[model samples]
Target: MIKELVAGVVATTWKRLHGPAQWRILWLKHATFMIGVTGVVLDDHDRVLLLKHRFWKDCPWGTPSGYIERGETIEAGFAREVAEETGLTVGQVAIHKINSGFRLRMEVSVIGRLIGAAEPQVDGVEVTEARFFRRDELPDGLRASQREVILAAGATS
Candidate 1:
């Protein structure tokens, strides 16, 4: 029994020492300052660019999202995330909506038009596929919130 207790303690200590686990613990213990940005890119046909996430196997379809880097405005972060994920430079980004909740969250939806008819080159590790989909024909794998956002953006595009 004592041996088992010692092993458990060691395992707990090792997890605490790991980077991501430590960050999660600190975030839970103290108020976390988690900030994220999402980009909405519209094509000439009004189709919206969507990213299929590689990590979220349970919910594989998600928007192009990333945490805002230090000293980065939400707009800059949004633009950078879009370019990084889809290889498209966004121009004339406007904050269409904001969604904030319990985790110091900021969901800033910005609208931008695709500069050219180039295919998206998936560059981010989180993104497995990047494609444009009509609002009405969005893939069933997308999260409900993401589908809603795409539909709303399409209507206004």
Candidate 2:
């Protein structure tokens, strides 16, 4: 009985130390501040993709963005954001710029070319519309931050 208790404690302790919880603990330890990521996706016509979120109707149209997942690389998370929000696959993600402010979350803007799935598939839940807009003729209600990211990325390309 004593041996069994020791083994069980060891097993549970191992699981807690090496499981998903460990990742979160490590992430928290390493993260001095939270980080966010957004992708500037361009289609064949050089237009940028923007999403209209249903929940944030009052906010302007924004690019596909989300927090980086535990154990996921920033590029992978960026691509995942594009796919989740617009149902579009991205190729060759490259860092455009890093937006940082004192005491504010840092955002990484990545640029990528759309590889497949030209038409966007919005679920009508979170994302209501996903469409490509020309740089000079972007739709109204585009968030200023997103607009700046797009313009800055466009300038470097």
lDDT of 2 by residue, 1-157 (tens): 9999999997788686855878777768774776699878988888999888777757747888887876788889898888888788998898777888848478888888899757999887788898898898888787777888788768866
Task: Please list the C-alpha lDDT of all candidates, in the order they appear.
Answer: 0.77, 0.82
The alpha-carbon lDDT assigned to residue 41 of candidate 1 equals: 83
What TM-score would candidate 1 get against the native? Answer: 0.71
> Which lDDT tens digits does candidate 1 get at residues 16-84?
697987777777888757676776788878888888888886877777788889888777888788888
Off by over 4 Å in 1: 1-32
